[model samples]
Target: MSSVVVVVVGGGASGLTAALELKKSASAYYTSPITVLVMEASSRLGGRILPCDVPVEYESIGGGVLYERVQLGAEYVHGGEHLLDVFLSQKNIKRIPACVAAQGDGGPSGFQESQATVAYYCGKRKTFIRFQPDNTSSTEPWLANLNAHLRSLADDSNATSSAATTGKSVADGLPRDSFSREMADAGYGNTLAAGSCTLLDEGETRIMEVAWDKQASGDATPEGGMSRVIEELAADVCDAIRLNHYVHTIARDAETNRIRVGYVASYAHPDDANSAVPEEHANEILVDAVIYTGSLPSLAHVDVSPPLPKVVIEAARGSSHSPVAFASEAIKAAVIVRGCPYGEDSDTDLHAVICSNSLWPEISFRRAKVGDNLWVCGGFVSGTCAEDLKSACISRAGAARWRNETCVVLLEQLDSMFGDGGKGWRASAGQLIGDHDAEVVPPSNRVVGAAAYAWGSDPHARGGYTFPRLPGASHVRASLNAALWPDVRAPPFFLAGEACGDDDGAPMTVHAAMESGRRAARRAIASIAGRGTLQSRM
Candidate 1:
């Protein structure tokens, strides 16, 4: 009996997990050795899970090299269950409950002094309304609108097929997913409203609302960062990963009944700079099965000879081509700043500041694990689609310039909220940012450094995450996950990623992506085992 050669493409969370799962199951599930290969397009793994170091001074905590590990993606453990939370628990990792502070739009102060409060900024009147969740009467109107929206969404889900055939857009649906409209009607601006609706699907939005109601929060990163999970997962499959291998094509080899994968060497090894290997020259590999964990956009661009089933192609195409429909684009900016902005007697324990403005819907500030003087503050900006958001991060001036602009905006907002009434802190912040025409704006001592990234701009990623808009998306995902016709003599091929799940309860999440990979790996194994059993019988 020959070993089954399985190739996992895209060494992100899903691909790595699939490879690890397949390796761990070698003895239990197969009679022969199973060879697993993980091909990553980028020089590094972890996909959208990016972590960077922010310098912090640790004078209070014994004065060591204290730097805060800030996460640029997948920050929270949503619901605190599933494989991610379990892994964290097993590793004895700690999760910090996020506390939120919000300032109403056009409020006298850009930020409020109170913590754990929800402030709605009225774009029309330019006033802020602070809502107390405990006050049933005050919150009844918003709750009513939310309940109504959910009912409408449920109705739309039931009638989606008929509506789609009738040429109805998502806007025509019963619930209609107008988060901004709903929020604006409730006196809050489109900033928070759009932010919520754009990031999550209808079902996910509902779940989040429930979680918010409970106030029983999910956890943020452990002390260092969320990269530990990636490091651990990659460690298990490190030997199998082929970094900087950009897969451009996947084809079925009719003669050998194997899958032919074509990829180009995307980068140069530091030691082999003198080597004359052309990066453009395509390399080929033959595998018994393939688990594609690449992004939807990357999958769309791949040349599939003897095209995949129409359903699979349609699903991938729908995800990639429809930039405005299914997915959301976002830019995250992290700024390293000095001084204590909010706390008791200038010692603020504030973790996050939710804004009603469009520039930064939410700004989070967290103290460094080791450094008492350093803090990392980040703001998330949601755009209408891929192009809109990508431009904000990847500008003609370059990412660094965009990052500086974003940080400047953040500092300005902070000046409004925390400034000493246009004198004390504001004067210091202006000096730090420097004048607009200064050619090179030096960061004042108060502002250490700033960095920004838009995941949609990444060559491999092409988008932040999946957010299925219409009801038909589930069917498409199911088709993508389904194996090709068993009667066909083609090679075994499977699709797995954040966008490959059919479950509405768990979609567009790290755990869901991992689950999808595990499922795909199992299917690939079963296909191989079934073929082996049939060959033996023959």
Candidate 2:
């Protein structure tokens, strides 16, 4: 008989959800009793999706804005409606009414453009790695399966229509599919293509259910911030969490076949990023297992006994270490020197100012409540790789910017050159994007974060949640997911998180990650008991 039960690591959205689902389903589906241990790395619970209060005076500054410019963080929620539905069923979250500007709303709440594709720098790759998925496992102890799946994707050249109608890669959307087309076109492509590239193989997983429409609508927030949702999820799994515990190492016991987790709980405190620390531990934590939800850089810095495999390490790097920076200078707010002449809507909440890149239009009075004594706080998303998008936004810009005519020109060209799967290739990307972000919310901070949450760069994700970048990205996520399979004899080891998915193509969204956690718990419960007890009697 095995000692103890299943062990879950990380307490972020994925970890917490996985633990709860397993515990819940064991009683319902498996008819078995199960206990799960969650191991989180940070002193705080919510990972990057933090939703704190920003004074109205401080609106138009940092990652927070009043009329809600949702600077560069998990502010707007793109295609997470399904997840929102799930949250509404499970928590106290409520959606607010949003008004994305149409051309002639008597309200004057008109938008210039919108998009569904995410734009980020691929570093100097000159060729930014276009992430995509292969819909296969990386661990069957063979490379043939990988090769086969990739070939199928590459051969999807029948000019067929895919489930996604968004735009395509800039390279795939050129005038003659020419080099200049790739150059003249902006660095970013359609939202679906970006998801395909970001999630790589993981996108192949059910997470692909996400919709990516720039001109579309329906993105939202927790009426507050994304953290409220995280807090709600945490409430369910609070019994298993231990805060301020900094994990140090993980080990495996050859004799007992059990995993050992180690960490220094309370060590010297660092006052700042460059603060020095003492060696003594004020507190400590050790476990039989560990779930590492930290970033790739954080993972690389930690120590592990018996160590992980080369493939896992390689995948971690490929999936997380994209040299892309998050610049959002375009969506910046300006000091209200002189307010707009036609901007006198008492009930109006959010508004946009369109301008040429070279002219570099300046905006003022980006506060929640418009007033004469307005002072706007602002910052630039400097050093980021996607400089083009950063230069074109005001407050909340991005794929959702497709509502603008100026943005339509860019999207239309992209679609004409690379229609859904490059079929008709004569329409506009903006039109396709129109169908993705289909909900109705003013293109505020909530909308932008909703749009960016799926990608990794939204500060909350630190870089579009996890996806296969190099060849190994899929393997890491897949391997981790499989480790908890029912066929295995040892106690199941479940993994979830944008970073903890299969190399076989998975999209990183709270919804996808949540479903993954549920599947993991289900698989673990099935594996622990005999297969006879897997399916319910009913």
Candidate 3:
């Protein structure tokens, strides 16, 4: 038996998974030995799953410098036995259940506590809604609508319709007018009305709701950084992965008829000034099959020889029905904080605070795995552009400005909800337990350092896992899996990524990426076997 050479483009979750899956299923599917290769454009293997390490010195608290790893990209396991979750559990990584808290007034005292409560501010009065486990009736208006939308999507009929229509907006099926009326009837505030109105597209919200449901079932990150998972997945195929090999173009060989992948020798070293200059056409490799796992935004920039099919191109760019998910810019910023805002004894709440009137949508407080009396505040930004968000993440000047502004806004919001000294409190047991004696760490003292990440800014990963911008996004996603060439003998190129919504059960998620990769790899292997090309080496 001869060897079948396979190349996987992009070293993200999908690409890595595809390579591994190819290796696993090779024996059964291929008549000969299979060689799997993964080409990564960036210097690192993990694409969007980045762990930004911050050195925090706890010398004052009797400890050394602890390198706290914060998630800048994909954080939180969306629960269930998805690929990531299964891997973590098998590796015996601890999974912590996330607790959600809302802000409410502490009686007359201005200090409000963030514990086991879901608070919403309406007009001048602060309303508190205690979180009850297994209770669904009291779900927030936004959450209720989201749940209903997910239900509709889960139905086979609706899902099939969505998969066929590639140019319809989500608003067409799930009208915003109906959603707004329901929220108004439920008595939600103006701020929430505006925020939830544009939270996500109707179908996009359905996907998010599915994730949130998993979180409620205890979505959590392992004790170590998420990059650890990537490391584990790449363990067996470490030798096959070529880091900093940015692919510029892909085409089929004219004579050999094999696939030829063209890439530049990218330098990973930060000090290396030559990293910016692409050694034009410096490197090329020919493979029997290529599984492209790069994101949609990334593929749009790369030139494909002989040109890709119109449907594939439309999926790469954006269609009227499937507006690019990248359009909804996502920005996450994290800052090291001293003194637990929820108190020392507060149970681990994945999401510590939900503020109705604040610049940040929400902030999660995590107890540092390495340091004591250490916590971090982080959240996503809404109504921001990709360029502005990207600038805040990359440029030094932009980062400094972003940090100061975020810290200031966070302090004001926290004080408004928890500064009990300014307001009176009802003296009743379990009514309002004011921890006034506890030292209130000022923003200056509490905020040791901060960092930000803008997914839209990344050149290799322009869009952080895609979402449905419009109703027909699902159809666009499905098109990615369709054959680029009209003949079905065997496609030279196969697509895999979160954007490939072939698996309707999981789209725009790690599970979807892995699933798509497996699907593409299997198809590629089967194609080679069917064509009887495995007998000869390319």
Candidate 4:
């Protein structure tokens, strides 16, 4: 039996999962010896699962410093009984609830009582609306009505049809109030203008597939962070991964029927003086099969010898198609404070603060403790807000400037929401110690460390994740699931990523990525074995 060489184009969760699964499948089912290689464009193994260390110094308390690893990407484990949860359990990684109510009696269902405390601040009214888990019925009738309306859109057939025909976006079907619009922005990670009604309808279908089993299990995070999952997934396959190998082209040899992969050995930093000069020398490798797990937007840049099917290309470019795919921009920023910034009256177990009708209409702050006294307040910006931030940051130069600007905005927003006449945060304004890389001095003395990541600015990942932009665009996901060479008896090219997930699988989740990888791996193995098809098996 001849040895089979399989090359995985990206080293993200999907790619790593594919490489590991391929090796395992080959041993279990095929006679040919399989060699799996993962090519990661960046210098690290994890693609978007970046865990960054922020060094914090307690200058007010005699200057004691410590470095804490904070999740810069893909922090939460969405549901349970998925591959990610299984992997984490096997690794003995503890799972903690992402949200918990600070003070609430158990609800009729028992689940609502444990729900996180979400404080809604209305900037226009200069008032705060607290959504207490136990008091949803009596205190906030509007919130309950909103929830019922959303559920009807998903559960009632007539409501779905009405939404599909009359509205361009999910928000269009909702009440035109500022509160409703703000809630939509926060939930969809995009402004109401960008939310597609088709996407919402399709998403509801996908949710139904797993909602029964997963409804009881809420969102969770590992004891430390998502980095633990990456570490465990890459443990056995680390040596097979090639870091700093940027794949440029993928071509198929008509005569030999083998796939040729071309890549550059090193990636030049965008800020480097010589970044403008293209690498004169390129490296190439021949493999029996190829699995691409990179972002859909990134596929447009890779030169395919025989162009991908027109629909795939259209999906990649977000151009003319029944349904177009758009890579949405998102930014995550976090700052470490010496003490709880919510003040003394605030609950210690407070989970998140959601602000509406403000400068950043849907900006929300999530709280987590990294140390005994140090707490992390993180905010995420997406959709049009993210695009605006990207444009503003570009005018200021590069990532360093962007990080500083983001931190400043975070502190300002926090102060505006929680500060007393904005004096609380302003009084704490001292020289922002630690993180010498940050050029801008923060305006708060409580801020000990700061960090931010703009996914739109990342060269490898042009945006955070992908979403259907147009009315019929949700169908593109099904098209993406098919292999590039589906007609071929033994297809050599397969696509695996969160973007490639089908209706049965939820897109844009870690478990979905892993499931796609597993499916692609099984198909690749069957193809190599001359089995021709694995659709039924998968």
Candidate 5:
């Protein structure tokens, strides 16, 4: 029996999932044996789901050391009952509710509680405002009114058509209040000016996509981190993954009637400390099918012989489609500080605090226990804020400078928010330790370990994820989903990624990526079977 070979490019959540799905289900669809190969450009397997251990040492607190596992990339499982949830459940991974309330059964699977204590800091007021989950407090009638207005807007957007909402943005309809704009930014991961309302209504939506259904209660963080999910997906197909293999070209092999994948393999020099002087070797492989699971913008770097379909290329480039998908910038930073920053009266169980009118476009902080009197405070900034940060970093130097600057900013923000009059704690530049290293001596009431990641600057990802802009049409994603050779009954080239998600109402998430991968695998298997049938008939 003749064997079939399938090449999965970009070993991210989607790519690895595609390879694994092909390996498991190919036999049922195709009569011949199927061989799956995963080409990962980066040195690591989890493309954007990077989890690292930052070493922390505090001599002031008995002089012990610990490694804090921090997720530098994708962290939360936005919704439940998806492929990711199933994987987590199957792996027996712990699921920590992202939100919890001080009262009332924690409000709809603890989401209500999360919403109740959402502390918003007003830079203008120089104070924090908490919106009670239940709007019974007449003291803040405007808060309840604003919440109602926002809900009404969401409903109206849902009722309206894409054409009617075209050229409109979330900011366009938002109340002319800084807090309102910040709330929108926190949800959409983009500035109100750039976040398209039409896309949210008709195109892909984020956590707000689906209502509070049984399947999707609310967001949750996996116990071990998102890396666990990646590990689970790649467990069986570990041998198939080729890290540091950059696929530069996918062309048709006229002689064999198969797809030829050309890549460059990087080998680190034995004596190089920085591995900057690595050797590059060009390689090629012939495969029956190819699944390109990279981001849309990344397509620009890949050379496809004879070119992909015009519509597909257009969609990838965001040239033809109005309100096309754009790469979004999101930065995440975390620091291990001494003592609980929230104070004794503050809600210790608080999940996250969304800050408005702050240094960044939209910043949110979450606290997790690291050890006795040691807490890890993590902050997230995205949308316009992240873009500005990226630009600033580029203007100054590079990502390293960005990380250093972000660490300092995060420390300052934390101090301003938690530190009384910005004096509760101070940042120790001398004692701050990198992800790998640990400082022997600890400073009093200072940050010991700090780490930050700018997903937009990451070469492998290009950006945090894809989001639609104003005047966008839902058909753009459909165009992105088009096969390389749609006219062919058994096209050899296909595309799958979070960006390719269609009108499923699912946002660009890990589950969506996995689903796309599975879909691509099914198409590849069917195409392989169809090709075999055509050959036999000929």
Candidate 6:
């Protein structure tokens, strides 16, 4: 068989970007055109770009993924500037700043929400320090910043539990008497667990072990929603795209090192009725290279020949596959009969109200552009976002929400926050470019404990981006980026994904994923094109 240059598996941003780059760059190296195949478990191409189909008036009522004024997922992006520049530049899209300092009461929002915390060894009950701020003119709206400072301090392995121990550290700056006293009482130690942070023991708690340190300086992102980020990338090869194609597995022959891939045909059994061969089975493809870009839950379905390496199987199984969630027991619609509240002047900082349980959402300005003119403008809500925001993002606050409109209610999980203190906020549908506005009403249901955004629950991305609990990180990049001489003989199976690399120990973000894809493509070119790891480029 004449080898295939690359087989890209994922259909997400990274996979698509890699395939696009490989298709364009690989031609220069190979005598024969390098063929690239993108295998996705789902039928559609936008892996996590599912947008809300709600109403523009919901902005006044509170519902949206990324308001035209604030960026959500990719909102607070930092390190991947170069990466951002390339994609945005290629797509002719412009990026805007979305970060600002504490805009509320100067005293720490002075409020905090307490979360369920379990002491690892002691098994003692201490709360994870969370905030339940009064988004009104109570205190320093810098609640997010203050908490961040505390987190940075908490992340410091050497950060003395007591200022006396480390002699004037971040702990010293904390207003022990002001508000975080509650957290201080709960105590701080390496033998602790917070959120999704899983440590391999105290040794892993070392300062450098886990740093929120992004590659480059991170800044507030698009107020225009990050969904547009993935959209623009797709525009490049949208023509070469296929939707609703579910891949069942990959078949391989160990003896000859030959491989065949399969997919679930849309219309099958009927055509092969009463026949030994059903055309509806997996659609197989034989090529020089293969790449899988689906999520972990999706990976469970791929059929690799002779079985995947034991190590690979074990690691994949062990890795945590969860989604970015937003839960609310009651979906409240706060419509001010008088004025719209948003931007600089308002107390909520104009961002969505994502409560501790995903209330009072503080998304970036960059995401706002994506909004279809649904942001609540002017004035402010007097009371805390409690009535409408609630303790969580689980259900609609009223019967009207569920009965009057459409919504998928998720409950019993932690709200996942990205770079900042936002409770994992998702999308809410709105009006189009020029559409009629609708009345706003809050949901009748209210969440008690947790309103999680479980991406694992989402059919699209088996789970959210990769986390670090699973093993094989160091070996991740190598396997995905490896290439062999097919003419020389051997079963070639290379892998690349944020799940596959170290990325200097950061969790799976868009940055790490894209980098892994490039590494894989470059490796294919060098070995097959007969070039070694060339300087810088590779």
- lDDT: which candidate is best? 4
> Superposing every Cα of model 5 onto the true structure, what RMSD results?
5.3
Best by TM-score: 4
Per-prediction TM-score: 0.75, 0.54, 0.75, 0.84, 0.83, 0.58
RMSD of 4: 5.1
- Tens digits of per-residue lDDT for model 5, 1-538: 6667899998888899899888877654445577788988778888768887877775646887778887887776765667777878888988876662111011223555243244556554556655565652475554554454444543444432144443455444556664554454444444322332334432222223222222335567787788888888888799788888778788988898898888887722232111232233358888899999987766766788878776666645656463455545778877776656666444444445655555443343445446556667666666565776666655544544656666666666666766544443433534353312222234444676778887766666666566444324355566666677765667899898877653443456687788878889888877887776322222
Where does candidate 6 have its weakest 10-residue lDDT segment? 114-123
Candidate number with the higher TM-score (4 or 6): 4
Superposition TM-score, candidate 3 onto the true structure: 0.75
Superposed Cα deviation of residue 308, candidate 1 (Å)? 2.4
> Which segments of model 3 are wrong by more than 4 Å?
28-31, 60-63, 99-130, 133-218, 268-279, 318-324, 352-354, 382-444, 501-503, 535-538
Q: Lowest summed-lDDT stretch of 10 residues in model 2?
A: 101-110
Per-residue accuracy of model 3 over 174-212 as CA lDDT, tens digit each: 445453233221221111122333343444434433333
Model 6 C-alpha RMSD vs. true structure (Å) is 11.4
Residue pairs that clash (backbone atoms under 3 angstroms), model 5 = 101-113, 323-472
By lDDT: ranked, best first: 4, 5, 1, 3, 2, 6
lDDT for each residue of candidate 6 in 228-280, tens digit (9 for 90 to 100): 66677567656545555556656664454445666654522222112232235
> Which 10 successive residues of model 1 have the least lDDT summed?
102-111
Q: 235 in model 3: Cα distance from truth in Å?
A: 0.9
Segments of candidate 2 deviating more than 4 angstroms = 1-7, 26-35, 57-72, 80-84, 97-217, 267-289, 318-465, 470-477, 484-488, 501-506, 530-538
TM-score, cand. 5 vs. native: 0.83
**Model 1 lDDT per residue over 335-370, tens place:** 766656553244444443444433565566766554
Local distance difference test values of all predictions, in order: 0.57, 0.38, 0.56, 0.63, 0.62, 0.38
Compose the digit string of candidate 2's lDDT tens values, residues 188-229.
212222311222232231122121222125544455556676
